[model samples]
Target: MSSHVPPSHRRWPAKTLAALTIGAFGWIAPAAAHFQELIPTPPLVNQNTGATVTLDMTFTHPMDHGPVMDMGAPKRFGVLVDGQTTSLMDRLESISVEGKAAYQASVPLKGPGDHIFFLEPAPYWEPAEGVMIVHYTKVVVDAFAADEGWDAMVGFPVEIQPLTRPYGLYTGNLFSGVVTRDGKPVPFATVEVEYRSNGLIEAPDEIFITQTLKADANGTFHYAMPQAGWWSFAALLEGPEPMANPQGDMVPVEQGALIWVNTQDMPQPSTN
Candidate 1:
């Protein structure tokens, strides 16, 4: 039951080197082989409801005659929406443990915001089950454009924040709005969110999030919980400088840094 077993680093002891050389007609023994590297990557996609989202998680290895192990059943896959995790689908396209196919998945833009997804191989390894190691992939999707009139800023989104798990709310969730130049909303602007840890930046422990959202009419937007982590939200104006309100002010679409927000602490995922 010990999980800290040491790795086999050496081939033989010091004394064995002499005898092995003289055992045969100078028949030099072949080198020891290393364990095969797994399918380095996991498949990911911005699947939508009613849309065909292809499932292509092919790795560096080949398909017909590659170094892949069958998972018999697709039990090692899972899915997550925005921030609330969901179960992986079983009826996918012509795909296996290491295959790829054009799948159709309907992206549900039921509302305006950013939807983030994380895809990775199931961690548990078993010969009776499949591969020796596991992996995962990640992706993001944005559907919005404000200022022109198609923004959700004027009113609440169709999808309300859930009060509990499977439909609950979290603090890491992000919100954005159309930035105006001269009392006018900037249409079709993009917003990005980054994380800062202990006042320092660029640290992996406090890295930036790849996900971004678009602004709707009137220059407003929002991105739901993508993950359970500390983050700073920022807004930008894609269009030209807004004529100052006679006072003289100028700012770019890149709002420079993220806006800090307070989030409620929640329990970590249960291992059971």
Candidate 2:
């Protein structure tokens, strides 16, 4: 959401690499917020579906500097099920501990396209780390969704992956029966997400991750779905966006809005 997609640790596996590079996100650099980093993020959604992914988190040193997490013992931390915050808490659902002792969370996509996720650090077992001013690290993810504005006028499928796993997906959803103003298909147009992060970021170059897709000449498109969640995808009415680019998916796509998409908990219009 910051002009750039947040950093996903996948690009830098070493603990030291992450620490030294903390300044990349000036605001998250040891800021006094309830922020913590959950390595290998987007923490594999739907474990209930038997689809579980392992995620890890780190502290500067002596693990004891953190808190006595709810999962208990090495690799556990307290969690917060946050949503409804749309501003700083958008795309985030629940933050809990995983069996691997890493932080695990369940996030519902808001629509299709690109979106932001800010993971708050877990409470350290000790009060010092808990009270210390720590900045939050960010990871970027691609999200796909349709009809985010409740108009049901447009629809699309979207994908979002973060640098943490570089290849690790974070969202995948679908939308059906999306139509254009003239009863034409929105394919061949384009789909993208317009976003910003918690930091007071400006300029497109500051963004982190953005995944763009184009509909075939027939106005239909297919993109890789990272995982399961709500997503928001859009089409630029006027431009040359969607390209064979990864790492950063947007910027070129400017001035477009939600079209057709798919998401969870949303009911299709009943023909009955």
Candidate 3:
């Protein structure tokens, strides 16, 4: 049998070939929910440990263990303690996570109280979804034995105000918070939750990767951690107005109010 094709049938146009290839392989997969991670190394700060805590800031899909996205310098990064906010932007050190730009900082605990660390990441242009994503993210670290200020608000455009203390939680504790935008509750807001997987555990299905829930009329939502690890709660909403993309076309923006909390397993009974 002849392996050669006739001259008339030989070459296909570039557009035609590209169309055929795409039809065979299908289009790109849908975009997964993006999470802006602002994680503290030792989630809890206490007297037994050191005075300085290291925090890692990365944009990723935590449950999937990433195809980490490059992150620009944050618009704002700071800590709030006892009704005062201090800027930590000057201390940020550039780093790389999964070959993508990330950041880290070491913050020293000055005294006992809840240190609320917050980050307003530069708006990320997500071509996959044709929108910009800006997550106003925060996490609370309890210093020494002072748990009083754990619920203080950071005053982000969109943020989660914790109804339950944000730190020192057991694996099964119910973490609750209210979704607020401009300091007012967002009634019936949508919240997404994901576990910071250690890459050892596997999701049985794609649906298990990110858990979705809705807040009540008061904008309060709750979820009990099923495993011992860090968990994130993101209350999603639309930005006030469309923002122009790089191409100078106005597009919608996704504003996520996110908070991260850590949970640990209860200590087992010691054998004598």
Candidate 4:
């Protein structure tokens, strides 16, 4: 999370401008949308499962299975249960994901209710996009069949308030949520969606990689997931103020409100 620029990444302003010039006309392949992933192993915790769950945090293109990016130490990592927020920063263990810096944590389920895990990652500099990226990401783990409290908000700078129950969904079920920033609706906010790649499916084209949609006047959006897996919904917005880049130059910031949910295939009836 250090703002200091590494000598290896430091480059002259002229070269940076040249690279942008070339990229503007399509010399470089379009970069896939970045998604901050906060995924829980097993996704759901029930009476039949273990007492603890493992969470993986990483910055990457979930749909592309990555060339993962290095993630700095997070600014905040914690969980919310029954309106109480507990910091889990000390429990984070540094890990290598795809040979890139990432993090993992083991969280014990204290009791029944929805455990809302949230992360505020260090700002990431994306030279290609010429912006500092910060994604406030979260995921919900339902424990002991206590289905209440799934709609609680973490009070991030920007976030999605779910209109649909985020867990225990069947494939093709429609998901809905409202985009909010500073506790107010962000009308017509653009949301990017991606399915976590398991390496079994391939995108036929770039269009198939990331799906984009716009929230309505009420800052609400709805999407039906076509497959069974972990899916990410990211509501993108511009930060109110610019941030200093590696070069100490002020640049725009891309603030994202992200949430991850999982769906399963419905079991079919047995033949008599």
Candidate 5:
């Protein structure tokens, strides 16, 4: 059999072929949930650097994989312990992650107790969404088994008050939290959940990238993590007031109350 093929159809570079195929289908992956990731070096510090914990802060979509967005200097950074909060903003150091502006800070754990480190990032101007984005994020570190202050709130415009213990959990435990804005429950608020990807898992569909759930009348929701890794729950709501955009026009604020908790796989029974 003799057939003549077009010159362009004879051969193509791998990269060029990929680009052509994608362009032909007009294929685009789903946008990931915009999460303010305040991940500590160690989710739990048993014995640490002079009782200090280092945290890496970035803004990105954790589930759909990242095209990490640049994070500006945070407005506030602090830790709450024994019902009291102390400012740590002066400790923030400029850094880069995935080629985007990010921050790193070390928080000193002063005593035998659980400390909740929280950050109020400067409002990020998301041009695509045409609104300012801000995420008030918090994570808990337990020291010396004091086991207190895990339920304390950081008093952001929006915050998550954990109903379940925020730490020391095996995988498959039910994690629960109450969504609050201004110290009041937000009835039926929308919450988005994402797992910190290990780069080996793929989403079955666009909708599967960021799992969504609605809170009950009391603004509480819960989920059982299927795998062992850091999981984030974000409760999103509208800001109280609109902020002026670059064009000097008013635009709504997209605010989020995000919390991170880590889980470990259950140990198998030992055989004698």
Candidate 6:
């Protein structure tokens, strides 16, 4: 997320504007990773009755850990279960994080199965990249020991259909998913991976800010977590149509299909 300086409002020279919009260093602005996060408390729901889960939705760089961007009200929020979807957008409450606008919501788990929570946020304008971003984010919460429906797709413009069980993953386990756009596999897609670095981990360099990989010809990709924490996988693709910026000009729209998964460490050996 870069500064939202509309070109119509700036008097910079054409060459300087091009350099800034293209993200150069020093004289130009560098592109930052934009991630729409929908992190849920407890990550899994064990009980059916009186089981309420809270989700924190925000736009930020998870690996970088700070400079939270303002997130407008989400356009869509819902849960998919047993091939059915329910809208929870009305339940979202305004929340604040890092002195920026964010959102939070609580969902009561009344049935036994996997509840797939999804969010489609309003497009964020990034002047430095000269594009708007719309990330369709999702997370899976297994309820009452039921194991079904973890891989069900909500049918967004872009989304990740998990090949591995999203929940119950161990730290070293390999996670995989297929990147789909308009319900079809997107071959050779770029997927960005980042961990929620909660001050315990440090990047060796800027290259480690967002670890990226490409999906296979069939649109499947894999990554193994190195430690226990929350990790996000974002598949970036260009939208079919451009969107209107504040300047009333048609600009590129970057659509991201993102999923968050939690991993736990193996048990300690004989601490007692």
Best by lDDT: 4
Clashing pairs counted in every model: 37, 61, 0, 0, 0, 0
Q: Local distance difference test, per candidate? A: 0.31, 0.32, 0.85, 0.88, 0.81, 0.85
Candidate 6 worst ten-residue window by lDDT: 1-10
The superposed Cα distance between candidate 4 and the true structure at residue 208, in angstroms, equals 1.0
Candidate 1 lDDT tens digits, 1-272: 11111111112332256447676656443221111111101111123333233333332122112334333223233333444555445533335433532122333334433333323332223222111322222233332421121121111111112111211236554444344434355554444444323233332321132345666665566766544433433342222222222234332111111222223457789999
Quote the RMSD, in angstroms, for model 4.
Answer: 5.7
Q: After superposition, how far is residue 136 of candidate 1 from its true place, in Å?
A: 3.9
CA-RMSD of model 5: 11.4
Q: For candidate 3, lDDT tens digit of each residue in 40-137? A: 97888877888798999999999988879999989999999999999999989999887999999999998888999999999898864667889999
lDDT for each residue of candidate 6 in 1-272, tens digit (9 for 90 to 100): 11212222222364466776765554543354888989998788774345899999989988878679998889999999999999998889998898999999998888788999999999998876677889999999888879998999999999999999998989999999999988999888888898998556787877787888889989999999987989999998877778998798998788899999999998879967
Question: Deviation in angstroms for 61 in model 3?
Answer: 0.2
Cα-based lDDT at residue 18, candidate 2:
54
Off by over 4 Å in 4: 1-28
- In candidate 3, the residue pairs with backbone N, CA or C atoms under 3 Å apart (3 or more residues apart, or in different chains) clash, namely none
Tell me which of candidates 2 and 5 scores higher on lDDT.
Answer: 5
TM-scores of the candidates are 0.27, 0.25, 0.89, 0.90, 0.87, 0.88
lDDT (10s digit) by residue, model 2, range 62-119? 1112332332222222221222223332323343433224444444443343333333
TM-score of 4: 0.90
